[model samples]
Target chain A: MSTRISLDGVDKTFTNRRTGERQQIFRDFSLTLAPDELVAVVGGSGTGKTTLMHLIAGLERPDRGTVSTGGTRPRLGMVFQQPRLLDWTSVETNVRLAATAAGIDTTEVAPILDAVGLTEYARSYPSVLSGGQRQRVAVARAFVVRPEVLLLDEPFSALDELTARRLRLLLQQLWLRTPRTGLLVTHNALEAAFLADRVVVLGGRPAEVVGEYRIDRPRPRSPEDPELFDVHRRIVAALT
Target chain B: MTVTHPVGAEEVVLGGGRSPAPPDRPPATGTAARLTRPLPALLLVGLLAAGWQLMAHTSDSALIPGLGDIARNLADITTSGALGENVRVTLTRVTLGFAAAFVVSVAAGIAMGRSEWLRRFLEPAVLIGLATPGLVKALLCVIWFGVSLVNPVLTVALAAAPALTINIAQGVRAVDPALGEMAHVYRLDALTRLRYLWLPAIVPDLFTGARLGIAMAWKVIVLVEIFGLADGVGYQLNLEFSQHNVAGVLAWTVAFALVMAAIEYGLLQTLERRAVRWRRVALR
Candidate 1:
């Protein structure tokens, strides 16, 4: 009853045109996340990490079995690798778009922008904003929906180290403020260790869960914390 | 014309207000910057005028009238009120033709772009339509509609529609699948999907199609008018040609060229800026 997202024996495959090869991304994979648990799914580049997120988001359907969220169709929010903001519209309108699509009041737009530290940028177009700022707006747009299940696909991977660190902290704060069941697909073990209640490593040719670690230590745990560092090391070891 | 967005220029976002930048330093200036400015466009025009004048002086022919004679004819035509009336007639034809072409082509383009079945059914016909000669269309229109307002307008639309269709179809096909996936994930409504994802994705191609459509419309409208219709600048040009009034031909041409320039620089450029202003920032 507490499960927010359940993938039951999912299979996904894609074709390579040039080589005429069929690459299987996932086969007989299953994942279940409890409500309000932040799970970080980490894997190598081509190991079906993003594919898993896509399947859950319903952007990609499973070839076999089912990928169900909440009830029939749970409200979903996503922060892509790129900001994916509407370039023609202003930042406020971009956030407002998701809210509007969800039939949430326009009033939530201002406060969400404020929370993301983008109040001044509300009227500014996405093109004018820095990469980091654009990503922040995307994050704000994702959070505005108060989604039943939030999916992030390497959301901080594109940012530089300092900006990535800052955004990681920002993402944590936002998630804490309104805790939702979420899946963050990331390559960064440190990021996985810092954010997730449980870190799942996906590996092998047709990726399934290779390893899972419980970071039982409470959050607001520092990057410098010895216990957190130990978890980060174990996750990285599993990924390699 | 050289279009410059000053480094750190405050753009007008939604609700039409510029968020001011810090006025700490004056905009960047250098020799390269000054040379790259739009002033060079005027210099190019001056050079072209000088070349034209020199050619007229050397040819010593009635067909190639001096610039001065052309200017005088322009003034005479303006005072007589024929220039305005002819321009109005021509523009009306172009507007009707372009509007019709735009609607039909965009609808067809979207249909073809979105569906494999529709694309297969229509793409060959569309290609043949594009390859069809404007002169052929003009003559056919004249035969069908007679030498009246309908002939020129219909001919322009038929002649121009293919280019718009082709361009818009290509634009729609070129839409980023990543964005499409994003829209799907977010579960945006059809209208919102079109407005945000589809429109922005197809904009570059749409503008290209519009430019091509307008240009073709101008050419087709004038051709039909010159051959069949009794009014408009093209008809006047035909009349001047029959009368051997070379100066009059040049004068009418100048008037039409000026209007086209105004449309390009004044209207289209402004619209392009507003539509794709985000690109400027993204590029920087």
Candidate 2:
């Protein structure tokens, strides 16, 4: 039996008491995430794709809905756009924090840090690390715990183009290595097409699933691949 | 670790020790720049002292205490244990007041920062406290607790707490919301999250508030002491003024200023440097 996430009839809203303004971000939003499935959520900024993941991650609660994973509350792991690495902790200690939280041993940390290629700077503070290195630390922290589901919220948005591309490939490899459910949210259509097995578009004030596409491309995907261009076009069409 | 690609000519990536864009365009590695920078402050101190000594000699003035006279007075007071006793009283009261204010301020700040409703209601109250004249509060303290160390300490705490709370709440507010969400999803243990995430995020803010707390506490403490009590450096200066001894009053004021300066530059500066060494790289 593999892990699965189901969100049913979710409603979320926020009201400014002083201005008497109410913004309803999502109403009757529903989603079902398949086990070990790599899905990309692509949308324009402020589509509440991040908010959707927040709901699924339980960082937030929907004003209305029942959300579940594999008939239970599964462990959640996340990579934010900014590295969000704790400034005081070293790269290694940060990864260790995740595993230790889930009642794991210190032994796995070294290997996981090695996987992210940050073993050399294990004790270096986040302040000293480069932007790309910081994002790698974020990825390492997310992957170390081996959660039932992983959420990436524009995880490569801050990196330079070359760095982002490299990380995108590494993320593909990471998803392959673990049988964990993965949901990546991004505004970049090319990134969505390249990394995800399925693509989803979220938009509107009362956000609904606007579009969906499936990529039948092979592993070691090439940027020049004709099939990727087709998927990319469909995703771009969904954005506007 | 030494692997370096090309950085801009202006940027000193790791240890190259040059910064970009100061109009001089000096070789950042040159001793000339370093030598010129300290000259102005040195000259200013020198001139002030020379002018003070000159004025004292010309007027044969007892009222405008000369630099040497103040120094001798400091020595006399310290040796007689009068300075030490007064300092002990002032410092004891400051620490008690600051600690109490720190505790209350941090709790209220965090509460206000975390909740909009709480902030909306309490923010005005905090501002009111901050807006009220600190001496007025000191007067209130005298009325309530009478003329004692406790009264002054209470005055200082009331004056300091609201501002400290506001400073800290702004710091908490400034923290990236994504980090909070990330912490929750990572499921970091409460203590670990605090130590790793919350601590660094708030340390700069907390330190700022602590700095203000120390300053306000000392200032209010001394003023309250002078206004009500009959002991301490403040009161001694008060007594000196009553006797029409301007030199003595000037000497006591100098002593209090030096003490406050010493606390800030010596203790708090050292602690801040140690805690946030990362900032020095940029500032330097």
Candidate 2 backbone collisions, by pair: none
Isolated chain B TM-score per model: 0.83, 0.78
| Model 1: CA > 4 A from native | A1-3, A217-226, B1-62, B110-121, B147-150, B172-175, B282-284
lDDT of 2 by residue, A1-240 (tens): 367887888888878989989888888888888888878998877788888888888887889987777777777778888877776666788788888987768798887667667776677666666788788888878877877888898998888876677677666666767758878999887888888888998878888788999887876566556677677777777767
Instruction: Report the lDDT of model 2 for residue A19.
Output: 98
Q: Which lDDT tens digits does candidate 1 get at residues B1-284?
A: 11111111122122223223312333545988767766777798889888988999999998888899999999999999999999998999998988888889988898888888998998998888789888888888988898777788789888778888888888888887777777777778988887787777788888888888888888888788887889999899999989999999999998998999888878887788778877775665
**Global Cα RMSD, each model:** 7.5, 7.2
Please report, as a residue range, the 10-residue window in candidate 2 chain B with the lowest summed lDDT: B1-10
Query: By lDDT, who's the top model here?
Result: 1
The reply for model 2, stretches above 4 Å from the true place, is A12-27, A43-48, A70-72, A87-90, A93-107, A188-190, A201-240, B1-43, B146-149, B188-199, B202-208, B227-231, B239-246, B282-284
Error of 2 at A197 (Å): 4.1
